[model samples]
Target: MNIFKYINEAWESLLSNKMRTILTMLGIIIGVASVISMLALGEGASDSITNSIESMGTNTIYVFRDSSVTNSKTLTLSDT
Candidate 1:
């Protein structure tokens, strides 16, 4: 029922198994670092794509010819 007793027992256990404690701590650190790096990489990639789109301006037009559609017409300079 005493909080200090539980804390003392946990501390003793951690000290008794030094290797296990160290390995567990290392695993947690590595897992957390990997998650943080992955999130940062995803955020960076998103920012890069967003910047590229913004740099192209809102009036940018993309033209593509569809080979599957025979009725598709090619864009001419006069169309713009």
Candidate 2:
């Protein structure tokens, strides 16, 4: 009923089944470790992609022309 009594009972229960206690702790440790590792991996991948995009200069632009347009002419140097 009191704090110390509750703590004592909880400790006793844990100690009563040694194998179960160990297995439960192992599962919790493994779950936490896996979650942390996955987060680190995702952060690393995000940073890599960000660095790649930044390295390619911000002023880069892409142009697309439809070849199927009958009268469309390709721009030449003098057309600029």
Candidate 3:
């Protein structure tokens, strides 16, 4: 059988299971929506942070260590 024929056959099979197809499409829609929203929020947050950092000063060096290391350093507001 040709590729077109096989594709048509598969499409017909999928159509026959309308409920399953709808559920699958719904799943894809939810997944894509979640990903898009997350990406947009993340980008917006990053842009905001970059703006804030740039406005602060070019000499600032932001460093982050693990929780345990921070505890050992006796970190406080004075470090900032």
Candidate 4:
């Protein structure tokens, strides 16, 4: 209810438990960093997929004759 009391209590607690506060902050920082890295990786994967789709050959019917055919279905930029 009181802003001054809240501030005073927070400051006192922080000052008294310096190492604990810093450790908690570090955990939060690591979580945020991992979340950012995952998002960036996801975006990169999506962009690559988009580029691949855009460069697909037109009127080329993909024949999935065999699943073991590695070079059969994949169309690279060179094929575009």
lDDT of 2 by residue, 8-74 (tens): 9999999999999999999999999999999999999999999999998889865689878899877
Per-residue CA lDDT of model 1 for 1-80, tens digit only, reads 79999999999999999999999999999999999999999999999999999999889987777788988776789987
Pairs that collide in candidate 4 are none
Off by over 4 Å in 4: 64-80
lDDT of 4 by residue, 1-80 (tens): 79999999999999999999999999999999999999999999999999988788676766456777667666567986
Q: List runs of model 2 lying over 4 Å from the truth.
A: 61-80
Global CA lDDT of candidate 1, please?
A: 0.94
Q: What shift in Å separates residue 24 of candidate 4 from its native position after superposition?
A: 0.2
lDDT of 3 by residue, 1-80 (tens): 89999999999999999999999999999999999999999999999999987898978866677765534665588886
| Highest-scoring model, TM-score | 1
Ranking of predictions according to lDDT: 1, 2, 3, 4
Give Cα distance to truth, residue 55, candidate 1, Å.
0.7
Ranking of candidates on TM-score, top first: 1, 2, 4, 3
Q: Which ten residues in a row have the lowest lDDT in candidate 4?
A: 57-66
After the best TM-score superposition of candidate 1, give how far the Cα of residue 69 lies from its true spot, in angstroms. Answer: 10
* Global lDDT of each candidate: 0.94, 0.94, 0.90, 0.89
Candidates 2 and 4, the one with greater lDDT: 2
Which ten contiguous residues of candidate 2 have the minimum total lDDT? 60-69
Give the backbone clash total of model 3: 0
